[model samples]
Target: MRGTALGAGVLFAGGLGGGWALYTKLSDNITADDAAAAELARYERERPTALVRGAQNILVIGSDTRAGDGNRRYGKDSGTERSDTTILLHLAADRRSATAVSLPRDLMVHVPGCLQSDGHRGEPSFTLFNSAFEVGGSACTVRTVEKLTDIRVDHYVVVDFSGFKDMIDAIDGVQVCLKKPIDDKAAKLRLPAGRVTLDGEQALGYVRARKSLGDGSDTGRMDRQQRFLGALVSKVQSSDVLLNPAKLYPLLDAATSALTTDPELASLRGLYQLVRGVRAIPTEHVQFLTVPREPYVYDSNRDQLVAGRADALFSLLRADRPVTVTKKNTSPGDSASPAFHGNTAAEDSCT
Candidate 1:
């Protein structure tokens, strides 16, 4: 399913240039003077780095933008950006299993205090979770997550809107089973649904499809993407892409071109390590999770996620503990939750 799912992206404060050497982008108005630059230099040096061990957590993002050549052809976009998708991919210490956690963008959160690109003092604001990226980029988002989950974010990766299309096209296409017709004006999709393996454009629309999909809720959309990701991962591992050099060549090119990651993880070797670790997850043990959520009781109009449950989930990841997906409904979760699929043999065997 990894194939159909891509993490959502976008955040401007201090982003890297997809290079091995970390390149920071400063605000046009805020100049980094000598002292400020020196301090940042020292900070970079002291920034703790971790080695690949047992369980791990990596934040993956998919940028919602139409600024690239392929994206611009699709439609005009607003100047601002938002995370089209967000997923926390976790691998156990032994690398025998894996899990991908999806965080609801609209879930109201206490955005931790941080410095913005404009040198403005940012206080803890009650805003949508995605706002962390908008106000302070990946750094602030990481800070906010640390504050909320207390889980150390090892590294981050980003994928652009156009690049995702390129990836789908590069892989030829992905199979999808659609039972109903789709004609979503918002997603710019029009297709009579069935069991169809979609191409680049159609697949993109399929994953981003909101209005014409299910209930048009972000939660529903996440479910669709997660399922697709599962299918994608299955395809990659099952197909002879690696064994057949010809098939693997296009795949590698697309992956490198479409991905942007922290400097230390921008190389082919780094990617190979990551994919190897993940592939070790026996086909049965891979899983997906959504932050437990409930309707916004305080606002009634939005969502107020179940904070304690989410905290517990992250704690499990931080400790590299095997996640016990609660399947027998004791909660008010919908059928969309993949975790509720019962604790079968596949639940406990992974790393």
Candidate 2:
């Protein structure tokens, strides 16, 4: 199945990054308030659990800050860059069929009015949605997404480059099949081809190096990232870590040290339960894709996501139904040519 091995890698990565044992890590780091973390965790536990729907949307952000020792090498004396990486995973309620959609950080979006630990404070603005994180934080980003897509984000997860490495290392190493050699000066990675295992450090470079890969577009990087993630998923499912206590401990410790999640997935137990659905899902049903896109309406240099296509895909997930992306040939009026015809969704795995 697609990503079956990668899923296993992701599971180990999750633990290496940290588990519920360290759910309090993020809560402890927040300067917000004493009662805030508990309140958030409580709300997450008590949040209205939903029935398995065909699809669901999750916003995954990869922060660029190299604030800690583990991350400094990636940043290398440079200031933190924008999240450059944004992915939206649409999972069928059944947890069988899935699709990963990537959003370019440069997409011009309508940032909406938001709320945070405090009460309402400002009006909406017109800028990229990712900039919302820099301006305010999660609340603003959530509100902006709500405003732009009218999609109520059920959950949110934010991980930095350091976390990605820790997660990779926790899984021991993920095996990847490379067709050719790669040398990226930016990420400081020069690797040969073959199915070699990747540690967190090497994995980080593998995902972040774009200049030496494909068309040198962020879109190309995203494609490779998806393949890596897919492999990570497969690894997690087929591996014995979840069933092996000895291997699980170090993985959990690493993951806990590197992560900071929203209140919903703030605790180790909470995050585990949510991902448990994916862990149990079948490999063939999972797929990854970038949102349908074209050159920006204004700037030829940037890419703009297709409006109705993404929104429609999200709708299918929200409904827990099946959707098949078809390809259009080079014939007349063949503007869209979807690369993959992802399979239809099936039974809810969570159930």
Candidate 3:
């Protein structure tokens, strides 16, 4: 009997040791963006102040960097990268609501002078929004966003193509209902109409496919991306991925392996603190919308923010106030009662 008890104790200790090793491995997968933090600190006095005490604003950037191993298949090594997708994610101070506002890559904005790779400061110019990333990477993109919205970015996360695909696969694919068939050779995606579950590769192609979907406008593409993300959030929250340790480990490994984040969110503990608030928020409170924008007057291909409309939305976010959204379009004249065209996680459905 004494031998049996001793053996059980030894086995338990071994199990705990193995768990710690796995934890360390997963935590170490995150790449800390210390250089970006140092760059931002250089202009600390000029950056926006935190408006709300506990509210957090994280800039999530999808990097189109083709230099990495798994990324080269997308295209030739361009020697530079761009912010393929940028979303300013706002978490309410009370931690009851969350909003994700997608910024159009083609939106024309003032790209502030940022430090370039050549070690020379590039002159500030009004150009496409994504150019900020191509010029200076994550630091420049965060600075540009702060200047444009006057919202303090608490942190930033840059996820590459391979990481995005791996994360989707870790979740075992996400389900979406298509209204029509799609075949885009450029995006390397071909899918039939109706309900379907997309693997990582197919999911990437679906979100990035512009020409073959909608009216071939970036605006329409943004809307589609928002819906897909909402679906993803719902999937993660509703599934056993979070509750079951077996299913959760793969997700953490995949997510951490693909992330390059600010120093504040570089560890497992920091990410857990952030995710704690996110997971508790009811899915119905999770909202997704694009900033108010229209085609540029000079160039129809480019986009420009709609006057009054965009500022009003930004003001609500800056003050950490609730942002109301709906599928119905609101009156352009009534900025006082602003309800932007958007959908909530609860509203996303195949029907």
Report the lDDT tens digits of candidate 2 across residue range 1-351: 222332333354457545443445533432222233443343343232344543466667677776766777665645434565777666677676676666666677776554333545456676665777665455455455545555555666667787678777777877777777777677776778777788888888888777777788777787668777767766666546555645554555555555555665655555555665665666656766666667888887666667666666555555565655432232212225223322212211122
Error of 2 at 169 (Å): 1.1
Model 1: residue 334 alpha-carbon error in angstroms: 15
lDDT for model 3: 0.82
Alpha carbon deviation, residue 149, candidate 3 (Å): 0.5
Per-model C-alpha lDDT, please?
A: 0.61, 0.59, 0.82
How many steric overlaps does candidate 2 have?
43
Which candidate number maximizes TM-score?
3
lDDT of 1 at 243: 45
Q: Which candidate, 1 or 2, would have the higher TM-score against the true structure?
A: 1
Error of 3 at 34 (Å): 1.1
Residue 30 local lDDT, model 1: 15
Error of 2 at 62 (Å): 0.9
Candidate 1 lDDT over residue span 1-351, tens digit each: 332111101111113255222112111111212332332234354343334455577788777767767777655776546677888877788877777788778878788665566878588898888887777666666656656666666667777777777666766776666677777777777777666677778878878776567987887788777767765676566545444445444555565576666654555444445555455566567777677778888775467767666666766677777775554355534433323322222332112
1-351, model 3: which lDDT tens digit per residue? 011111222223236658666656766888999988988999999999998899999999999899776899988886999999999999999989999999999999998889888898999999999999999888999999999999999999999999989878877888887888888888887888888889999999889878878798787788878888877877777545555555456666778888999998887666766665555677789899899998899999999999799999999999999998878455434698887888787764576
Off by over 4 Å in 1: 1-53, 73-75, 119-121, 326-351
Supply candidate 2's per-residue lDDT for 198.
Answer: 83
